[model samples]
Target: MTLNDLSPILLDAAAPMINPRDVDKRLPDMIAGGLDAVLATAGAIEDFRTTMEDVAKWLEIERSGARKIKIARSVADIREAKASGKIAIVLHFQGSDAIEDELDFINVFHACGLRVMQLTYNARNRVGDGCFEITDGGLSKFGRKVIRRMEALSMAVDLAHAGPRTALEATEVASRPMIISHANARALMETPRNVSDDLIRAVAASGGVVGVCAAPFFLTKDGPATLDMLIDHAVYIADLVGPQHVGLGFDFAEENEEDYVYFGYDERYIPMPPWTFPSRIASHAEAGNLESSLRTRGFGEAEIRGVLGENFLRVFEEIWGC
Candidate 1:
């Protein structure tokens, strides 16, 4: 059995349509599509208390017993889940806003089983400017310290929605392999949220991987994206930085037309409601189609495997060292 994967936010109060605990409803699609693990966001620009609650919710899901979902705090945990026919959930933060001004909060969250965190969201936080910021000042003095502290604690730093300068600058500060969890190559799609070739190379130079997102707008300009468009992104990054530095992170969210604001998405960066992901592989159940599309696009077995999930797992092992 080949490994295929897509990452999604497990739970969001704003998007109540998604409930991972419903094994009969959603878990089958994920399992049938071979989604081995997900990077469940504990918080995105929320404060400490709310973030901790998010963590608690995930913990509750793990204990729910309604679904075979296990929280993977390490690579070993991931393997264990895979062997036992359970879905592994990697606790993640889409942004570091939960930490507020304190760097010690990173340690606390790590202790609470947060293995990955993005430095910023669509807008700036105390750490640095996000992609939406007018002036890309890069990381703050405190942001640099946060990076050092995270590295020491073995938590993978993500640059998904960070500003261009901030993402590049972060690579310079981060000694370990970092990730741009769910972004497309900006060279292909000229979105502010997309990662640049320079940033992609910088991330790869540090032995990191960039996961190609399946968001329709991020893939193409005007139309709903297709699986071909998604593979085009994978091919672009693979050709640029090699297949080992590429992976899949389909940042899927089930939101009502009105909850975008509640989710902290600005109108400037996000498209209007009823946001559609790429066709053919729209949801986790259809994600298996990606492998065939990649093969048809002239991707080899190993390259396709790396783009599937092994690439991200490799970087996780490097940072987590287990």
Candidate 2:
């Protein structure tokens, strides 16, 4: 089955020393790892000018390597990319800070090929409160306007890092499908970054899909995590919302201790070095192990396909309308 990761960090966030715009650097590895398409994270908590530069850099990379990477603006683009044996790169954001208080910039970025966007990163923003906020303010007036505009413009609204009230409020306001693009079940892991059952039910009730994250810290707090732990989250969501609303969103990244330190994640939430993922699915190249694990856990073929990519594709079609 084809795979689509809703939130793959294509660039090594920890290593700016390397060429950040060399988007195709992991192309061969992803292909070997069984990924057909990815909603490549393009910007997060960046200001307007910086985010625009990031988008321009991504476009330049696609232009220079058209044969290997296609900038997907619609479901048709993804389909064509798959047919042509090219990897689809749907530009995505992990926060709406880049748009700031200016709503018109949403149209500007949409024109530039950004298909998915999250409302907040991990704290309060102009849009709303992120998961890390001590007091959840929910979606602000500006945030509601942003969601309406995004729906009208055919862009996917993501709630990955949104606080409980923020996520619930956004779902209440959203007429079309919304997504928690990359989060795990809080019931299992007990982390604020993970979604609560209330949030998951609300999202799925609104016809949205939830992508299970693959970070070891979010999967388990004990020793090294195994692929079974990752599948456990997928199984929980699938059982809660059915297979059609479950998908993968491996927020994979190359990192060092300093990266998380600089990002200000709580020490307990940060896994100690050496930062190794589940051995069977260590890197993007080993993602196929997730499928094997799912099968071993008794998920049938159609359900497996949905978890792999179809669920996200269906939401993309319903929201993007292409």
TM-score of each: 0.91, 0.91
Which digits, one per residue and each the tens of the lDDT, describe model 2 over residues 94-175? 8998998899999999999988999998879999998888899899999999999999899999999898999999999999
User: How does model 1 score by TM-score?
Assistant: 0.91
In the order shown, what is each candidate's alpha-carbon RMSD? 3.9, 4.1
Give per-candidate clash totals: 0, 0
Please list the residue runs of candidate 1 whose C-alpha ends up more than 4 Å from where it truly belongs after superposition: 1-25, 64-66, 264-269
Where does candidate 2 have its weakest 10-residue lDDT segment? 9-18
Global lDDT of each candidate: 0.81, 0.80
> What digit string (tens of lDDT, one per residue) describes model 1 on residues 206-278?
9999888877778887767898998888899989989889888887766765677766566665776788877
Error of 1 at 213 (Å): 0.5
